[model samples]
Target chain A: MDVIQIVVIGLIATVLIVVVKTQRPELALLLSVAAGIILFLLVLGKIGSIIDIVRDLADRAGIGSIYLGTILKIIGIAYIAEFGAQICRDAGEGAVATKIEFASKILIMVLAVPIVVAVLDALLKLVP
Target chain B: MEAIRSLVQNLIVIIILAMLLEMFLPAGEMRKYVKMVMGLLIIVAVVQAVGELVRWDYRDEIPPLTEKNNEAELSGIMAAASRITGNQEQKALEQYKSGLSKQVRALVHLHKETPVLEVDVKVQSGRNEPDYGQLKEIILFVAGETSSGKESEGAVKEGVEPVTVQIGSTIETDEHIENRDSPAGAAEADLISMVANFYNLSTEQVKIIYR
Candidate 1:
């Protein structure tokens, strides 16, 4: 039922964007961004539940919170960067989209610094 | 066996998490970068779990590298570790000294002629010393008169005499002369030599104080 509602809203938004794009391109872009945000918000509630499940599983498996935290941060950064980049691409700003993605990649690597150091430290301890 | 079971369980959970997280990833170039980080996290988890199985403690997880200056933090950790080591060494030395003193007291008590009131033993505890933990000195505090017999007759006379050191290089020249002149000096010397021989120490290392 929720999917039906989402599909209907998406279709209506697409129709409105198609009808308005020729007359007012800026308005159409705004409508598309608005629709994307609405759809993301609708799905966001479900994402929280999925995250809770992952957290429980990680706890049971004896994984450290730090690793899980880093992974979660990377995922969030990727999702947000991808969302922004896609919007930029839709607006015909390919260069801006590329810059957004490059920034996200750097942020993800920065977040991963601890895990990388942990791996190296563990290996070093095992060696001697 | 329990560790193996838990390791398998952990791997399963990690794989499931990776799959679920992968589904959340965008179908774009950013996916690769995110996946790389997830892969490293899984690697660390697996390595740490294996370390636990081998009885090697991976308790000290590495802290965030970018949080502070690495050299300063490393030096701080080194200093703390050395301080803990020093405290433990000092405690062990104290216990060793007490235990050695008790053993010496018990040994001297075997000879009823000398009733030992107290025993003090010192050991070379310096790490740099070649004779570390070797008996450095043993001081026995004995009653003024022999506890075996003729105690009533000799106690008053022995009590009137001043404290005397039967052996040891640290003894004053006058005390050494007085110790030699004492009536029971030969018997005390024999007892002191017996103690030195038992501890593998030189005669001078074992000192007896008549109190």
Candidate 2:
């Protein structure tokens, strides 16, 4: 049911962008970004439910909430960064999109640093 | 055997969760980094599961990440709160001192015979002191008889020196009143007692410096 609504929105946005692109490229870009945000918003509730299920599964398995939280955060950051980069690419700023991706990679690495260290530490402990 | 079975079950659940999360990862450039992190999560889960089986206490080596973050953030919040409280307390004390000085100056103005030039009030500000915020002393600068013309500002500034009456305790003030040889001294003593009584303070605490 929601899929139909999303598809309709995407179709309408595509037609509008095709119609407006020749007149004002900047407005077309804005229209595309707005459409992306609208689509994301429509599915935001579903994302929350999915996250809750993951958290519940993590709890049931006796996995620490911290690990689950970090994984979720990484997923969120990746999603946002990918969205931003795509927007930049759509605006014909490939260099800016690349930079955004680079920043996201670094941020993702920083968030993973502790886990990496923990893994290394555990490995070292097991060796001894 | 039961513990081994449960450990395997936890590992299976963690793997399944990891697979589910991988499905949500953004395609293209970001996918590899997300997948790598996901792989690390699985590794961590496996290591923890093995550690649990052996009773090695893997969690002890690495602290609760969220709790550590929260503790650091909590300390920062507490520091900011204390800093704000100290600044607010200092501001309140300054306002209280200035307000008291204005009240004392106005109270002295009620006396037509002795014109007050200035009033300095000190209050007990020590937070630990039993009499904190209580008035400590009131120093009144009363104009002398020679400059009592009320417009003798220049004369008072240059030549005529105001009399200094240091009032202390109710008994000392009464003694000073008895020993007062000049009419002006007697009037100054009366003015001091009136103020002391008005503020419900001891006459000794109200000191008048005639200028």
* Docking quality band of candidate 1, CAPRI definitions: acceptable
- Top TM-score: which candidate number? 1
lDDT of each: 0.79, 0.80
Lowest lDDT sum, 10 consecutive residues, model 1 chain B, at B149-158
Predictions: Cα RMSD each:
13.7, 17.8
Instruction: Categorize the docking of model 2.
Output: acceptable
Interface RMSD of each: 1.2, 1.3
Model 1: residue A54 alpha-carbon error in angstroms: 0.5
What does DockQ give for each predicted structure? Answer: 0.49, 0.45
Model 1, TM vs. native? 0.55
Stretches of candidate 2 exceeding 4 Å from the true structure: B56-211
Q: Write the per-residue lDDT of candidate 2 for residues B1-211, one digit (tens) a residue.
A: 6668888899889888887888898997899999998899788878877776765343445555477788999999999999999899888999999999999888888988778888889899887889988998887876664322222111122244544455674332222223344555566767788888988888778877646
Candidate 2: give the clashing pairs: B162-B210, B162-B211, B163-B210, B168-B204, B169-B204
